[model samples]
Target chain A: MSQNRWAQQTLWGWGRYPRVESLVARPERRKEVLDALADRQGDPVLAFGLGRCYGDAALLREGRVVLTRRLDRMLAFDPETGWLRCEAGVSLEEILHTFVPRGFFPPVVPGTQFVTVGGAIACDIHGKNHHVDGSFADHIRRVELLVADGRVVTCGPDEEPELFWATVGGMGLTGLILSCELQLARIDNPYIEMESIRVENLEQFFEVSAESGHFTHTVSWLDCVTTGKATGRGIFMRGRHAPAGTTGGLSLLSRLGRAAPALINFPVDGPDWMLNQATIKAFNEVYFRKHPKGQVNSIVHYEPFFFPLDAVRNWNRMYGNRGFLQYQFVVPPDPSHKAIRLVLEEITRSGLGSFLAVIKEFGERQHGGISFPAPGPMIALDFGIAGQPLFDLLDRLDRIVLDAGGRIYLGKDSRVPRHVFEQMFPELPKWKAVRDAWDPGHVFQSELGRRLGLSGGQR
Target chain B: MSVLILGATSRIAHELAHRYAENGQSVFVAARDADEAARVAADVGVRTEGTCASGRFDATDFAGHAAFLDSVRETVGPIEVAILAFGDMGDQHASEGDFEAARHVIDVNYTAAVSICELLAASMTERAAGSIVGIASVAGDRGRQSNYIYGSAKGAFALYLQGLRNRLFKSGVHVMTVKLGFVDTRMTYGLKTGIPIAAPDAVSRAIFDAQRGRSDVFYYPHFWRGIMSVVKAIPEAAFKRLSL
Candidate 1:
């Protein structure tokens, strides 16, 4: 059967920055996806699982983007083992909606539930429990990858291990992921026994996080505007799954109550100056004082704990029309405090505080050669795209990250020099080799791959 | 129950097929575009636990209607409901000048539909139970100067469906005629009809409800019924004088 023709569209990542026009085809069937890959006669095509990457990793400027959303389907599930096999386009939220009541959940989920299984694997996203469960790739048992030669190969840790690992964090540049088998975790209930601790500075954050090792999940929200005596004053939170037979489980009413009432979206992008340091500092002061000084424990629904920002529909629009840049980088466990403090000091001195600053500890690294996480502390800061000064500050931060033996997450990066990217991920050469072995023609290329010089010399 | 959706590649028909498949009903999609039919079948198959199949069906091929129905029955079991949803609203201006164009429009919207309905009616009569749905258009109620050719074809289809319903009423087989208005579909892609277009999914939902209720003849979006009534009530002298 002849594949459907492509429609030209102007596409952007979740950040809504750096828009690119591309030829896109939405193939509804597995055969059409295969046929599209086989009969590639245009610029290299990248399988866009969902537009949730927050960066250019899923974009293909003036190229083809094969949309995989229509290919979503749950092929099989094993209730006993909590094992699930589904097409790549299936979102994490879909899985949760289907299996949460059945006492099962995806082992690792990112901040946003809008991510697809394929996007999760490509980014190798991590959750708050990264200090325990590692990244999304750790729970993936196998993947059916459609490579450049029109062949569907089953890849796992043992079978085609190199291809599997390369494709795990390969950012859709290795090939199109057809479907995958994931091992889900069994949750006793849909509630979390959470503890929130108010910390004064970065030092207290480490102490509280160290004491939270036994907890299933741990993360912190830092107030970036504070400096001097209170350099990273914020709230630290830890949580564990509530046991079954708990008083308040995740019933429909409780779930609805936990969800924000009538989600309010920022209808339009306000003036660029609306999110200046003055406004953010004021908001941070109120936010910081809102939490009590001592530890507060509560049994809360997992929705608010896992995805607080998701409550608001278009929260990203708060960053204004230019959109925002999320700068997320991880520094090695050794000298992590000094490195993080230095990064924070730079932000404070610049007087451009991010409204949303998050910090989490990563566990041991996985076998995915290009995976982002390591045994370190990862910080993510969102800065509205003001102008060149913001880019300049980020470039300076990149040097600090590189010197501290750290790397930035490609899934959240829209602008990083190719040389810096190479220095960050040392396994790129090996990943590129594996990618070339499978796709010698480099039929699966993306804008991010080209920007990072990972498009198999096509640039 | 299994549904046989002829011209399943049409936007409205495809949406209806998905609705049926999602409800765990087996669906067989028949369309002239082989790739589209197969894609829709696979998509619907994954959505439902029930079975789905696709086959080549050219609506204009009058000789192939009987064979196609037989093949569908052999492959997908008896059709509990059959939707005749294929039609072409040819270029009215071109049709006025060309006999072939006018004939093509009539054959697709009327003659071909009549052929398929006859075959389905006979099969359903033998089974003693089934529903046959004909998707005619609201333009059939009263013709205007702009699109009389297409409207006339739909008008003829609507009359044929009325007779079919009367003939099959005693056989326990329900025949439904749907008069759709201003549907947003690929067929009306570039034409600015100056009316609020209805979504195919919404129209499909209405069709499903009407079929379940065994409605004989209903206008999709319901409000179209009142509008077409007013249109049909206009005197021919005044209707022909005003450009619609």
Candidate 2:
């Protein structure tokens, strides 16, 4: 059947990138996706698992895009070992529903469970638990890849090491991913033992976040508007799963069940114009007020603990017709103070306000150099592309990132200049070497790849 | 296209710059004060230079009207499309109470625009391909007791634009008079009225649309078309009694 571009406008986790192209093919099976990829005529092929990559990383411009949503199905689960195997299209939401009842949960999640297994592997996505559990790559046991030659290869840390590493954070450039076997973490209950704290300024925020390093998960929202005394005033939320007896009457299984339907498997778009600055300010006030200063919340379920923002539908439209570009990058951990401060100052001076601004500390060693995650302090933001100043503002930001020994996240960028990107990610040659081996014809491509001048050169 | 905008400090003028810039067109924003115009240009991301600063354009300086037109033409170069977003919504009470105040509105709205249009229309007729847009108002449809002094000036400008449209139509140049309703701008901030307010973006979109399509006249909101029709049809005595 022909694909429906209108229906597949957005993937689960990544934001939307409009396609003026004709059809969007939804494949129910891995073979169908592979066949579609194999049969395409010279057009670029992009495998979209769950469109969760923040920007246009998964977007296939004027090309044949394979939608992996219908390929979702659970294949195996080992209750004792917390080992589970599922189709590439299977969502974290689905895994949470099936395993949380049996006392198992994903080791890491990027704020939301609405992303596909294939997507998580493709971007090597990290979550609040990234410092402790690494990324989705750490938990992934093995994955089956359907190469450009239509050959299905099973790869992991021990087998086909190059392809395994390449596919870990390859942005699905290597080939079409079929299924993945991920090792889950053991949890006593579905509820999380959460703690919330209020930070006064940029200095306090860094100290508080570093202090929370002892915890399993930590993240903070910094208000870039205020300067000098009041800069970075916001909330810091940290949490770990609750243990057996400590989480009573919380009905962990019931909470997971209710959350499963509303959250776990698939996420729909939020209502239009639902995230304006006024509304966001109101929400921030309420959120800050509700959580008392330096208070530990006793019981928090899967929904509130993970997917709080997904309660509404079609949230992206709130950015208006101009859409939005999510910008995220990590500054070197050594010069953390200077690097992070410069980033905030750049944003503030640009006079651009972001509805979603997040700052987190990282310990994960640099992956393939070009890969986004590194041992540094990472800051992420989303900006609307409506006005004239935004383009120039982003251009100014690119220079700051380069000067600070930082690199933009490929998975969440739509505007990084081609020259700047090449300079920042020097490990492209290595990734390109692996990409050449798996798909010698260089059939796989994405809008982001072309935009960054990656797909144009030799495989 | 080389476009020169008068009163380029207004929000609608800024939006005009955006529209032209996005389409890869060159624009020059001109204001009464060079510094103010330059600032507006910087904010709107357009090329700005001053030709009419120093309040030398006393529109009532009817003696220097011809010289003012010649100066603008000489400084800005041969403009392809001339947009007049000039004119003040003067204090209605002041205009009603003092004859000098009433004349101030007239000189700016009608006299200056007419003198400029005469010079511009002749140039456009010679070029035989330019467009001139004069922004009038719906208040000109029928004089309201609250703002008759200002409305009468707009009414005169509206008629002048119509005559220019008719004459220029033969010369292959288009003339447009936009009858704007209440716009949510700095100009209308203090007016305690419940009129449907259109954003400057919306107004700019209308102006560009009419310019591209070369329509002779436009009502900014378009709904004001049907509204003013009923308004004009109303009898004057009854209309005056109905506080609108």
The most accurate candidate by lDDT is 1
Model 1 per-residue lDDT at B43? 55
Query: What lDDT score goes with residue A295 in model 2?
Result: 53
Give the best candidate by TM-score: 1
> Positional deviation of A420 in candidate 2, in angstroms?
1.4
Q: For candidate 2, what TM-score does chain B get against the true chain B?
A: 0.89
Model 2 CA lDDT for position B193 = 58
lDDT by residue (A38-83, candidate 2, tens digit) is 6687777878866667676777655777878656655556677877
Give one digit per residue, the lDDT tens place, for model 1 in A7-110. 77778888888788887777766677887776567578898876887888889887788888766767677778988888899899888877787788889988
Candidate 1 segments exceeding 4 Å error: A1-3, A38-40, A247-263, A456-459, B1-80, B83-129, B134-162, B170-172, B177-204, B215-244
Model 2 backbone overlap count: 16
